[model samples]
Target chain A: DVKVTQSSRYLVKRTGEKVFLECVQDMDHENMFWYRQDPGLGLRLIYFSYDVKMKEKGDIPEGYSVSREKKERFSLILESASTNQTSMYLCASSPSGTGIGQPQHFGDGTRLSIL
Target chain B: LAKTTQPISMDSYEGQEVNITCSHNNIATNDYITWYQQFPSQGPRFIIQGYKTKVTNEVASLFIPADRKSSTLSLPRVSLSDTAVYYCPLAGGGSTLGRLYFGRGTQLTVWP
Candidate 1:
Protein backbone atom coordinates (compact mmCIF):
# COMPACT_ATOMS: atom_id res chain seq x y z
CA ASP A 1 0.00 0.00 0.00
CA VAL A 2 1.09 3.58 -0.59
CA LYS A 3 1.62 5.39 2.66
CA VAL A 4 1.95 9.15 2.98
CA THR A 5 2.80 10.55 6.37
CA GLN A 6 2.64 14.15 7.52
CA SER A 7 4.92 15.69 10.11
CA SER A 8 2.18 16.82 12.45
CA ARG A 9 -1.48 16.11 12.95
CA TYR A 10 -2.19 19.28 14.93
CA LEU A 11 -0.12 22.44 15.05
CA VAL A 12 -0.48 25.88 16.58
CA LYS A 13 1.55 28.96 15.74
CA ARG A 14 1.51 32.59 16.65
CA THR A 15 0.95 35.41 14.21
CA GLY A 16 3.97 36.36 12.13
CA GLU A 17 5.68 33.07 12.90
CA LYS A 18 7.14 30.68 10.43
CA VAL A 19 5.50 27.28 9.92
CA PHE A 20 6.66 24.18 8.17
CA LEU A 21 4.58 21.13 7.28
CA GLU A 22 6.38 18.08 6.04
CA CYS A 23 5.17 15.09 4.04
CA VAL A 24 6.89 11.88 3.09
CA GLN A 25 5.81 9.02 0.87
CA ASP A 26 7.19 5.52 0.74
CA MET A 27 5.89 4.59 -2.71
CA ASP A 28 8.54 6.57 -4.58
CA HIS A 29 5.85 8.64 -6.28
CA GLU A 30 7.00 11.51 -8.49
CA ASN A 31 4.16 13.89 -7.65
CA MET A 32 3.33 15.61 -4.38
CA PHE A 33 0.82 18.32 -3.50
CA TRP A 34 -0.27 20.64 -0.70
CA TYR A 35 -3.79 21.94 -0.15
CA ARG A 36 -5.81 23.82 2.44
CA GLN A 37 -9.43 22.89 3.20
CA ASP A 38 -11.95 25.35 4.55
CA PRO A 39 -15.65 25.12 5.19
CA GLY A 40 -17.77 26.02 2.11
CA LEU A 41 -14.56 26.89 0.22
CA GLY A 42 -13.47 23.25 -0.21
CA LEU A 43 -9.92 22.10 -0.70
CA ARG A 44 -7.83 24.60 -2.61
CA LEU A 45 -4.44 23.74 -4.00
CA ILE A 46 -1.56 25.69 -2.60
CA TYR A 47 1.38 24.16 -4.40
CA PHE A 48 2.49 21.02 -6.22
CA SER A 49 5.83 19.51 -7.15
CA TYR A 50 6.32 17.28 -10.15
CA ASP A 51 9.99 16.57 -9.64
CA VAL A 52 12.85 17.48 -7.43
CA LYS A 53 13.40 21.27 -7.44
CA MET A 54 10.42 21.80 -9.72
CA LYS A 55 7.37 23.54 -8.32
CA GLU A 56 4.22 25.21 -9.63
CA LYS A 57 1.71 27.58 -8.12
CA GLY A 58 -1.85 26.39 -7.82
CA ASP A 59 -5.02 28.46 -7.56
CA ILE A 60 -4.16 29.84 -4.12
CA PRO A 61 -0.38 29.95 -3.69
CA GLU A 62 -0.07 33.26 -1.93
CA GLY A 63 1.94 33.23 1.33
CA TYR A 64 2.89 29.60 0.69
CA SER A 65 5.96 27.93 -0.78
CA VAL A 66 7.04 24.36 -1.39
CA SER A 67 10.31 22.44 -1.38
CA ARG A 68 11.05 19.04 -2.89
CA GLU A 69 14.78 18.53 -2.51
CA LYS A 70 14.31 14.78 -2.66
CA LYS A 71 11.84 12.45 -4.27
CA GLU A 72 10.34 11.11 -1.05
CA ARG A 73 9.86 14.34 0.84
CA PHE A 74 7.77 17.48 0.24
CA SER A 75 7.57 20.43 2.53
CA LEU A 76 5.13 23.31 2.78
CA ILE A 77 6.42 26.60 4.18
CA LEU A 78 4.40 29.41 5.65
CA GLU A 79 6.72 32.39 5.84
CA SER A 80 4.48 34.54 8.03
CA ALA A 81 1.62 32.71 9.59
CA SER A 82 -1.61 34.56 10.30
CA THR A 83 -5.06 33.79 11.56
CA ASN A 84 -6.31 33.57 8.03
CA GLN A 85 -3.71 30.90 7.31
CA THR A 86 -5.14 28.55 9.87
CA SER A 87 -6.60 25.57 8.09
CA MET A 88 -6.51 21.83 7.59
CA TYR A 89 -3.43 21.24 5.45
CA LEU A 90 -3.33 18.08 3.36
CA CYS A 91 -0.50 16.31 1.54
CA ALA A 92 -0.82 13.79 -1.24
CA SER A 93 1.40 11.76 -3.56
CA SER A 94 0.94 9.84 -6.77
CA PRO A 95 3.11 7.66 -8.93
CA SER A 96 4.02 9.24 -12.32
CA GLY A 97 3.46 12.63 -13.89
CA THR A 98 1.47 11.37 -16.88
CA GLY A 99 -1.35 9.11 -15.86
CA ILE A 100 -4.94 10.26 -15.81
CA GLY A 101 -6.35 7.44 -13.71
CA GLN A 102 -3.89 7.28 -10.85
CA PRO A 103 -5.59 7.96 -7.55
CA GLN A 104 -3.56 10.08 -5.16
CA HIS A 105 -2.73 8.67 -1.75
CA PHE A 106 -3.10 11.19 1.06
CA GLY A 107 -1.50 11.73 4.41
CA ASP A 108 -3.48 11.97 7.62
CA GLY A 109 -3.43 15.83 7.37
CA THR A 110 -2.28 18.59 9.67
CA ARG A 111 -4.69 21.01 11.29
CA LEU A 112 -2.82 24.26 11.77
CA SER A 113 -4.03 26.95 14.09
CA ILE A 114 -2.63 30.46 13.96
CA LEU A 115 -3.29 32.74 16.90
CA LEU B 1 -7.84 21.03 -14.82
CA ALA B 2 -11.52 20.48 -15.44
CA LYS B 3 -13.99 21.88 -12.94
CA THR B 4 -16.61 19.51 -11.50
CA THR B 5 -20.13 20.02 -10.17
CA GLN B 6 -21.72 17.97 -7.37
CA PRO B 7 -24.57 18.25 -4.92
CA ILE B 8 -23.99 20.31 -1.79
CA SER B 9 -25.20 17.54 0.50
CA MET B 10 -27.15 14.29 0.64
CA ASP B 11 -28.96 12.23 3.26
CA SER B 12 -29.50 8.48 3.33
CA TYR B 13 -30.38 5.69 5.73
CA GLU B 14 -28.46 2.56 6.57
CA GLY B 15 -28.96 -0.53 4.38
CA GLN B 16 -29.98 1.72 1.49
CA GLU B 17 -28.13 2.39 -1.72
CA VAL B 18 -26.67 5.86 -2.29
CA ASN B 19 -25.87 7.44 -5.60
CA ILE B 20 -23.98 10.69 -6.09
CA THR B 21 -23.56 12.29 -9.46
CA CYS B 22 -20.82 14.66 -10.62
CA SER B 23 -21.01 16.70 -13.78
CA HIS B 24 -17.96 17.63 -15.81
CA ASN B 25 -18.95 19.18 -19.10
CA ASN B 26 -15.46 20.05 -20.30
CA ILE B 27 -13.84 16.72 -19.49
CA ALA B 28 -11.19 15.71 -21.97
CA THR B 29 -10.81 12.38 -23.71
CA ASN B 30 -7.75 11.48 -21.73
CA ASP B 31 -9.14 12.74 -18.48
CA TYR B 32 -10.20 10.29 -15.81
CA ILE B 33 -12.87 10.60 -13.14
CA THR B 34 -11.85 9.92 -9.56
CA TRP B 35 -13.65 10.16 -6.25
CA TYR B 36 -12.36 10.54 -2.70
CA GLN B 37 -14.04 10.26 0.68
CA GLN B 38 -12.97 12.45 3.58
CA PHE B 39 -14.01 12.23 7.19
CA PRO B 40 -13.88 15.05 9.68
CA SER B 41 -10.31 15.95 10.70
CA GLN B 42 -8.92 13.36 8.31
CA GLY B 43 -7.52 13.39 4.80
CA PRO B 44 -9.53 12.16 1.86
CA ARG B 45 -9.40 8.51 0.93
CA PHE B 46 -9.50 7.20 -2.62
CA ILE B 47 -12.75 5.44 -3.43
CA ILE B 48 -12.76 4.65 -7.11
CA GLN B 49 -11.48 5.73 -10.55
CA GLY B 50 -12.63 5.16 -14.09
CA TYR B 51 -12.03 6.53 -17.55
CA LYS B 52 -15.19 5.15 -19.10
CA THR B 53 -17.78 2.43 -18.79
CA LYS B 54 -17.97 0.94 -15.32
CA VAL B 55 -15.46 0.02 -12.63
CA THR B 56 -16.20 -1.66 -9.35
CA ASN B 57 -14.15 -2.18 -6.24
CA GLU B 58 -14.84 -3.53 -2.79
CA VAL B 59 -16.00 -0.15 -1.56
CA ALA B 60 -17.86 1.50 -4.43
CA SER B 61 -18.65 1.45 -8.12
CA LEU B 62 -18.09 4.10 -10.80
CA PHE B 63 -20.36 4.39 -13.80
CA ILE B 64 -19.42 6.49 -16.80
CA PRO B 65 -21.42 7.01 -19.93
CA ALA B 66 -20.14 6.98 -23.50
CA ASP B 67 -19.93 10.76 -23.69
CA ARG B 68 -17.94 10.74 -20.45
CA LYS B 69 -19.55 14.04 -19.55
CA SER B 70 -20.86 12.87 -16.20
CA SER B 71 -20.28 10.01 -13.76
CA THR B 72 -22.12 8.39 -10.90
CA LEU B 73 -20.77 6.85 -7.70
CA SER B 74 -22.83 4.04 -6.21
CA LEU B 75 -22.52 2.95 -2.63
CA PRO B 76 -24.22 -0.31 -1.74
CA ARG B 77 -26.17 -0.80 1.46
CA VAL B 78 -24.33 2.02 3.17
CA SER B 79 -23.64 1.90 6.87
CA LEU B 80 -23.84 4.71 9.38
CA SER B 81 -20.08 5.05 9.36
CA ASP B 82 -20.07 5.69 5.63
CA THR B 83 -20.85 9.37 6.05
CA ALA B 84 -18.25 11.75 4.70
CA VAL B 85 -17.48 14.43 2.15
CA TYR B 86 -17.16 13.02 -1.34
CA TYR B 87 -14.93 14.94 -3.77
CA CYS B 88 -14.89 14.45 -7.50
CA PRO B 89 -11.49 15.29 -8.96
CA LEU B 90 -11.31 15.90 -12.69
CA ALA B 91 -7.87 14.58 -13.51
CA GLY B 92 -6.14 15.81 -16.62
CA GLY B 93 -5.25 13.57 -19.50
CA GLY B 94 -1.77 12.03 -19.81
CA SER B 95 -0.39 11.85 -16.25
CA THR B 96 -1.28 12.06 -12.61
CA LEU B 97 1.11 14.94 -12.02
CA GLY B 98 -1.55 17.52 -12.70
CA ARG B 99 -2.90 19.26 -9.64
CA LEU B 100 -6.44 18.17 -8.88
CA TYR B 101 -9.11 20.85 -8.80
CA PHE B 102 -11.40 20.35 -5.80
CA GLY B 103 -14.75 22.03 -5.65
CA ARG B 104 -17.14 22.11 -2.76
CA GLY B 105 -17.78 18.41 -2.25
CA THR B 106 -21.06 16.70 -1.52
CA GLN B 107 -21.47 15.97 2.15
CA LEU B 108 -23.23 12.64 2.72
CA THR B 109 -24.98 11.91 5.99
CA VAL B 110 -26.13 8.41 6.79
CA TRP B 111 -28.83 7.89 9.37
CA PRO B 112 -29.77 4.83 11.35
Candidate 2:
Protein backbone atom coordinates (compact mmCIF):
# COMPACT_ATOMS: atom_id res chain seq x y z
CA ASP A 1 0.00 0.00 0.00
CA VAL A 2 1.12 3.56 -0.65
CA LYS A 3 1.39 6.03 2.17
CA VAL A 4 1.27 9.81 1.84
CA THR A 5 1.80 11.56 5.13
CA GLN A 6 1.05 15.15 5.88
CA SER A 7 3.10 16.95 8.52
CA SER A 8 0.07 18.27 10.37
CA ARG A 9 -3.58 17.40 10.56
CA TYR A 10 -4.83 20.64 12.15
CA LEU A 11 -2.95 23.89 11.87
CA VAL A 12 -3.66 27.43 12.98
CA LYS A 13 -1.81 30.56 11.98
CA ARG A 14 -2.31 34.27 12.26
CA THR A 15 -2.80 36.63 9.33
CA GLY A 16 0.31 37.83 7.48
CA GLU A 17 2.27 34.82 8.78
CA LYS A 18 4.18 32.52 6.50
CA VAL A 19 3.00 28.95 6.87
CA PHE A 20 4.50 25.74 5.64
CA LEU A 21 2.64 22.47 5.11
CA GLU A 22 4.72 19.40 4.43
CA CYS A 23 3.88 16.09 2.80
CA VAL A 24 5.93 12.94 2.29
CA GLN A 25 5.12 9.88 0.25
CA ASP A 26 6.63 6.42 0.66
CA MET A 27 6.01 4.94 -2.82
CA ASP A 28 8.51 7.22 -4.57
CA HIS A 29 5.94 8.33 -7.13
CA GLU A 30 7.12 10.98 -9.56
CA ASN A 31 4.02 13.17 -9.52
CA MET A 32 2.87 15.15 -6.49
CA PHE A 33 -0.07 17.52 -6.22
CA TRP A 34 -1.42 20.07 -3.75
CA TYR A 35 -5.04 21.16 -3.56
CA ARG A 36 -7.32 23.21 -1.38
CA GLN A 37 -10.93 22.15 -0.72
CA ASP A 38 -13.52 24.76 -0.02
CA PRO A 39 -17.21 24.38 0.73
CA GLY A 40 -18.67 24.86 -2.75
CA LEU A 41 -15.51 24.93 -4.86
CA GLY A 42 -14.63 21.24 -4.42
CA LEU A 43 -10.97 20.34 -4.78
CA ARG A 44 -9.08 23.03 -6.66
CA LEU A 45 -5.50 22.32 -7.58
CA ILE A 46 -2.93 24.71 -6.18
CA TYR A 47 0.38 23.34 -7.42
CA PHE A 48 1.97 20.18 -8.70
CA SER A 49 5.48 18.87 -9.31
CA TYR A 50 6.37 16.22 -11.81
CA ASP A 51 10.03 16.06 -10.87
CA VAL A 52 12.35 17.26 -8.20
CA LYS A 53 12.75 21.06 -8.38
CA MET A 54 10.14 21.27 -11.13
CA LYS A 55 6.73 22.75 -10.34
CA GLU A 56 3.67 23.94 -12.21
CA LYS A 57 0.93 26.30 -11.18
CA GLY A 58 -2.54 24.85 -11.00
CA ASP A 59 -5.87 26.65 -11.34
CA ILE A 60 -5.69 28.37 -7.96
CA PRO A 61 -2.05 29.16 -7.30
CA GLU A 62 -2.42 32.81 -6.50
CA GLY A 63 -1.06 32.95 -2.94
CA TYR A 64 0.63 29.57 -2.69
CA SER A 65 3.89 27.97 -3.83
CA VAL A 66 5.39 24.51 -3.61
CA SER A 67 8.84 22.97 -3.11
CA ARG A 68 10.03 19.52 -4.06
CA GLU A 69 13.60 19.19 -2.90
CA LYS A 70 13.54 15.38 -2.87
CA LYS A 71 11.58 12.66 -4.59
CA GLU A 72 9.67 11.61 -1.49
CA ARG A 73 8.79 15.01 -0.04
CA PHE A 74 6.66 17.88 -1.31
CA SER A 75 5.98 21.02 0.64
CA LEU A 76 3.32 23.73 0.19
CA ILE A 77 4.22 27.21 1.32
CA LEU A 78 1.77 29.98 2.05
CA GLU A 79 3.74 33.17 1.45
CA SER A 80 1.39 35.28 3.50
CA ALA A 81 -1.45 33.55 5.21
CA SER A 82 -4.82 35.28 5.45
CA THR A 83 -8.23 34.42 6.83
CA ASN A 84 -9.35 33.47 3.36
CA GLN A 85 -6.63 30.84 3.24
CA THR A 86 -8.31 28.74 5.90
CA SER A 87 -9.31 25.49 4.30
CA MET A 88 -8.49 21.82 4.03
CA TYR A 89 -5.25 21.16 2.16
CA LEU A 90 -4.71 17.84 0.44
CA CYS A 91 -1.64 16.13 -1.01
CA ALA A 92 -1.57 13.38 -3.57
CA SER A 93 0.98 11.34 -5.54
CA SER A 94 0.89 9.15 -8.60
CA PRO A 95 3.27 7.07 -10.68
CA SER A 96 4.88 8.48 -13.79
CA GLY A 97 3.40 8.26 -17.26
CA THR A 98 -0.10 8.51 -18.72
CA GLY A 99 -0.51 11.97 -17.23
CA ILE A 100 -3.90 12.64 -15.66
CA GLY A 101 -5.23 9.12 -16.19
CA GLN A 102 -2.95 7.51 -13.63
CA PRO A 103 -4.41 6.56 -10.29
CA GLN A 104 -3.33 8.78 -7.42
CA HIS A 105 -2.78 8.02 -3.76
CA PHE A 106 -3.70 10.69 -1.26
CA GLY A 107 -2.87 11.67 2.28
CA ASP A 108 -5.38 12.26 5.03
CA GLY A 109 -4.98 16.06 4.54
CA THR A 110 -4.06 19.05 6.64
CA ARG A 111 -6.83 21.27 7.93
CA LEU A 112 -5.40 24.78 7.94
CA SER A 113 -6.99 27.68 9.78
CA ILE A 114 -5.74 31.20 9.27
CA LEU A 115 -7.08 33.68 11.78
CA LEU B 1 -10.10 18.11 -18.73
CA ALA B 2 -13.80 17.73 -19.40
CA LYS B 3 -16.31 19.03 -16.92
CA THR B 4 -18.21 16.30 -15.06
CA THR B 5 -21.72 16.49 -13.69
CA GLN B 6 -22.96 14.18 -10.95
CA PRO B 7 -25.81 14.19 -8.50
CA ILE B 8 -25.51 16.44 -5.50
CA SER B 9 -26.48 13.68 -3.06
CA MET B 10 -27.93 10.19 -2.83
CA ASP B 11 -29.54 8.06 -0.18
CA SER B 12 -29.25 4.31 0.12
CA TYR B 13 -29.63 1.58 2.67
CA GLU B 14 -27.18 -1.01 3.80
CA GLY B 15 -26.92 -4.28 1.87
CA GLN B 16 -28.06 -2.43 -1.25
CA GLU B 17 -26.08 -1.53 -4.29
CA VAL B 18 -25.46 2.11 -5.12
CA ASN B 19 -24.81 3.39 -8.62
CA ILE B 20 -23.61 6.92 -9.14
CA THR B 21 -23.42 8.21 -12.66
CA CYS B 22 -21.41 11.14 -14.00
CA SER B 23 -21.89 12.94 -17.27
CA HIS B 24 -18.96 14.19 -19.29
CA ASN B 25 -20.31 15.14 -22.67
CA ASN B 26 -17.06 16.62 -23.97
CA ILE B 27 -14.74 13.79 -23.05
CA ALA B 28 -11.87 13.41 -25.47
CA THR B 29 -10.97 10.14 -27.17
CA ASN B 30 -7.84 9.68 -25.12
CA ASP B 31 -9.49 10.65 -21.92
CA TYR B 32 -10.16 8.06 -19.25
CA ILE B 33 -12.83 8.21 -16.60
CA THR B 34 -11.68 7.95 -13.00
CA TRP B 35 -13.73 7.68 -9.84
CA TYR B 36 -12.72 8.81 -6.38
CA GLN B 37 -14.30 8.53 -2.94
CA GLN B 38 -13.66 11.13 -0.27
CA PHE B 39 -14.70 10.89 3.33
CA PRO B 40 -15.31 13.90 5.48
CA SER B 41 -12.06 15.67 6.34
CA GLN B 42 -9.98 13.30 4.19
CA GLY B 43 -8.49 13.46 0.76
CA PRO B 44 -10.12 11.74 -2.16
CA ARG B 45 -9.22 8.08 -2.64
CA PHE B 46 -9.00 6.56 -6.09
CA ILE B 47 -11.71 3.94 -6.63
CA ILE B 48 -11.56 2.86 -10.24
CA GLN B 49 -10.64 3.98 -13.77
CA GLY B 50 -11.80 2.85 -17.18
CA TYR B 51 -11.71 4.01 -20.76
CA LYS B 52 -14.63 1.99 -22.04
CA THR B 53 -16.70 -1.06 -21.26
CA LYS B 54 -16.48 -2.33 -17.72
CA VAL B 55 -13.66 -2.42 -15.17
CA THR B 56 -14.10 -3.94 -11.76
CA ASN B 57 -11.89 -3.68 -8.73
CA GLU B 58 -12.13 -4.83 -5.16
CA VAL B 59 -13.62 -1.53 -4.15
CA ALA B 60 -15.96 -0.64 -7.02
CA SER B 61 -16.88 -1.12 -10.67
CA LEU B 62 -16.68 1.40 -13.51
CA PHE B 63 -18.97 1.10 -16.51
CA ILE B 64 -18.37 3.26 -19.56
CA PRO B 65 -20.32 3.04 -22.76
CA ALA B 66 -19.05 3.19 -26.34
CA ASP B 67 -19.62 6.91 -26.74
CA ARG B 68 -17.41 7.58 -23.69
CA LYS B 69 -19.58 10.51 -22.75
CA SER B 70 -20.41 9.20 -19.29
CA SER B 71 -19.51 6.58 -16.69
CA THR B 72 -21.21 4.83 -13.82
CA LEU B 73 -19.63 3.77 -10.55
CA SER B 74 -21.33 0.83 -8.83
CA LEU B 75 -20.67 0.00 -5.23
CA PRO B 76 -22.02 -3.39 -4.28
CA ARG B 77 -23.72 -4.00 -0.97
CA VAL B 78 -22.52 -0.78 0.55
CA SER B 79 -22.20 -0.22 4.26
CA LEU B 80 -22.10 2.92 6.34
CA SER B 81 -18.40 3.15 5.71
CA ASP B 82 -19.11 3.50 2.01
CA THR B 83 -20.84 6.81 2.60
CA ALA B 84 -18.76 9.53 1.00
CA VAL B 85 -18.53 11.89 -1.90
CA TYR B 86 -17.89 10.25 -5.27
CA TYR B 87 -16.07 12.26 -7.91
CA CYS B 88 -15.85 11.40 -11.58
CA PRO B 89 -13.03 13.17 -13.36
CA LEU B 90 -11.94 12.74 -16.96
CA ALA B 91 -8.21 12.24 -17.19
CA GLY B 92 -6.59 12.68 -20.56
CA GLY B 93 -3.17 11.63 -21.77
CA GLY B 94 -0.18 13.71 -22.79
CA SER B 95 1.26 16.91 -21.30
CA THR B 96 -1.66 17.64 -18.99
CA LEU B 97 0.26 15.52 -16.47
CA GLY B 98 -1.49 14.88 -13.17
CA ARG B 99 -4.04 17.65 -13.55
CA LEU B 100 -7.65 16.71 -12.82
CA TYR B 101 -10.77 18.81 -12.54
CA PHE B 102 -12.91 17.64 -9.63
CA GLY B 103 -16.30 19.22 -9.71
CA ARG B 104 -18.79 19.07 -6.88
CA GLY B 105 -18.99 15.32 -6.37
CA THR B 106 -22.01 13.20 -5.60
CA GLN B 107 -22.48 12.89 -1.89
CA LEU B 108 -23.71 9.39 -1.02
CA THR B 109 -25.13 8.48 2.33
CA VAL B 110 -25.63 4.83 3.23
CA TRP B 111 -27.99 4.11 6.05
CA PRO B 112 -28.50 1.03 8.12
Model 1 pairs whose backbones collide: A98-B94, A98-B95, A99-B95, A99-B96
Error of 1 at A76 (Å): 0.6
Q: After superposition, how far is residue B47 of candidate 2 from its true place, in Å?
A: 0.9
iRMS of each prediction: 1.9, 1.8
Candidate 1: stretches off by over 4 Å? none
Query: Candidate 1 at B68: error in angstroms?
Result: 1.3
After aligning candidate 1 to the native by TM-score, how far in Å is the CA of B1 from where it should be? 1.1
lDDT of 1 by residue, B75-103 (tens): 99999899999999887866546668889
* Cα lDDT tens digits for candidate 2, B12-106: 99999999999999998778889999999888988889889999989889898999888999999999999899999777687778678899999
* Worst ten in a row by lDDT for model 2 chain A: A95-104
